[model samples]
Target: MASIEKHGPSWRVIWRYQGQKQRTTWATLDVAEEAKAIVEGYRGNRTAEQVYIDMGVLTPEVPVPTTPTYREWAEKWLGSKTRISPGSRARYKQQFRDHIFPTFGDTPIGDITTIAVGTWVNDLRAVMGSPKTVTRYYSAMFAPMKAAADQGIIPVNPCKATDFKRDQRADDDTGEHKAVYFTPHQFEQLRAAFPERWRVLLDTLVETGVRWGEVTALAKMHLVAPTKRTAARVRVWRAWKRGEGGQRYLGTTKGRAKRSLPIGRDLYDALAALVDGQPDDTLIFRRADGRELDYSDMYNDVWMPSLIAARRCATHPPAPRGEQLAGATGRCRDYGGTRDSGEPCGARVRPGTTRCPSHYGPARNAVSMCGCDGVLVIDQPASWHDLRHTCAAWLFSDPRMTPLMISRRLGHATLATTSDIYGDLMPDLEESAVDAIADARKSAQGTRGKGARRKR
Candidate 1:
């Protein structure tokens, strides 16, 4: 037991060690409280002299073994990791530098408490929008502390003691987000909106559900033409990856497993046209200069523009009966009008008002002659990864495709991975699962009836 009390113009922490009472006096109450904490923690198995040394009450005959700082231990832990990919290693380093180091870099590894680690995680969850992203950073921080524990540097890993259950929000909560993907109709409109040159790339992505890196790394040899006994397929064996040093190269697939996905005749023809007369080693999808397409450039320059154009066409269709349909009363509002080019005046205006003189009316029926006319439009936002989810959604909607089949098609590491993501989306699968148990019970009852009749 330890207690802190006031002495003459100072504070004293009194405790017992090795059956003898010990006391340490400090100039301030804070210092006395800190000494009290040290005394309380120095329980069984710790050397008798450690308490005195930790409180700076006694000088040692030899140098005391000091615990490494969080940064020092983290560097050693990261260096010892050799099995991870260069890209993964780079990401881990980035997570440490950006998220963990600022708060705990100089803190002694042994001194970091579970409460401190838990507080850091909560702060990150507040600052970062996504819980999954926060979890990744948490894992990066947890690994080093776990290694420190294994190496006898600390008594326990503080991170392991944290209860993450409290941090999780319900699916419908404001901060929580689920997978975002385009519906089939929306995808069709989006695909139609893309330029002719890049349409096949989008087709391949939606059909096979391969990752962006995996699709970009595809070569002519990876595509296999249909035969008498085989279906047209694409072999996914490798992917384009960047290392910690920022060098790009072909690397193993994310799961380090090779999967061959059967493709439709339409997609096969599209892919074959790209690889026609090219060497087997030639990339199936690349820039005209024979360079791999960068994600940032493609997203900004192509995907976004195409997506916006498609949404616009969906919202605004061609004028009814060749006469521009205006508003609910079939007439333009005070601030709405057409320009000299016969296009609607798209100038910005004040909300809920026709005050701007730049146009005839503030509101009008959407009227645009675009390729996506009469096509279902998608207003929801999406990203490149959503293409993969789109494929999964499509597969789940089809009765012919089972969950296991969808998992393999998406190149998921396990069926559980696929189910964890798209399981709730598959109402048919859930119904079938219920029916299977019902059918099994009926079959068992019938079998028992037959046995009883035979015995009779």
Candidate 2:
């Protein structure tokens, strides 16, 4: 039955919605009419209605285990990831500590929302972390949450919906860095500044473009003569990793790369010539204490001093250049140097790329060639990494090699990556691209002018 209630002399109709059997109240005729319209619109029947219930739906709070702090989980993940080659594992550990743990470590995973994750990443970028660095941090931070989601411990991953927005280059940038190459002149000045052994280290690194750790890990055993099944080559199997546990084991190659490098004429001759009289298993580069030289000490004592010396040379050095250390040269050695190995150069370390240990470093006193006081001489400033950059640059700068090939030569994961960093080096070609398009446009305009004249 419908009833009319008096409200300030205006009649209000009260009615039931579902059916006589099902009791659902509507305050007025208009309310009943609107509710009937909705039910009809939804289910094609005005009678269909469910009682609105606002009771309880609890969000699953992901349990943060009390015994294991965020630090413990991070450490465990690092420890598990240590199966990878030592260098990569060390980087993972560094990323977790420096970026991941501090912000979200104590927070329970279930409570972390996508918006919060995005905000944290934005904060990290504001603090000046590189895109690459943040990318790694993103992976480490979310991996556990993802696992928790899969295990039904959490409803969703906080990091699941977020995309790292900073990968696009800064609007002012062209996504390329300028070239910071080591001049031949600077190389010479640098050579004379360090010990004969260090000179060899620097020179060989430039010529071969092998990493510092690779050089440090090089033992006489790894550079063995070839057998019947394979050609003569040097194995790049091991590297000394500096980490919490001290020197950790590294290297089995990342993907398709063979752990050994082919020792062709340059490498074969220099290594053979340099190590001719020495024993087979000797460490190629070692410290005074007979321990492997820590990478930092190697740079601080050897490479950096060489750079300082280069600055002192007569010719002022160009300020630091490009993406790579910009001086890692490589391939092999043979000529110049004038050593007793019976070869032409004998690995005496003249100034070109291929170099051996004995004549490796530059003169300690800065000559006019480098831009510094000629008075001081000891070690030069140069890290093996800078030398690696130099080596890749050497390949990229050549006319014959394409950027794609260079990427492969340098063991980069993708071609676009190599081009992104070094695209500016090939300025002529980039300019040519714009010119080519402009020329085509002009040619088309000429054709259109001819057509209009014909019409006239």
Worst 10 residues of 1 by lDDT: 322-331
lDDT of 2 by residue, 178-212 (tens): 33456555556667767776776776677656766
Q: How well does candidate 2 score on lDDT at residue 58?
A: 27
Where does model 1 exceed 4 Å of error? Answer: 1-67, 149-156, 165-176, 314-376, 426-428, 452-456
Q: Residues 59-133, candidate 1, lDDT per residue (tens digit)?
A: 999986689999998888889987778998899889989999999999988788877887898799789957778
Deviation in Å, model 2, residue 446 alpha carbon: 22
- Pairs in clash, predicted candidate 1: 333-361, 334-360, 334-361, 335-359, 335-360, 335-361, 336-360, 336-361
As a whole number from 0 to 100, the lDDT of residue 66 in candidate 2 is: 34
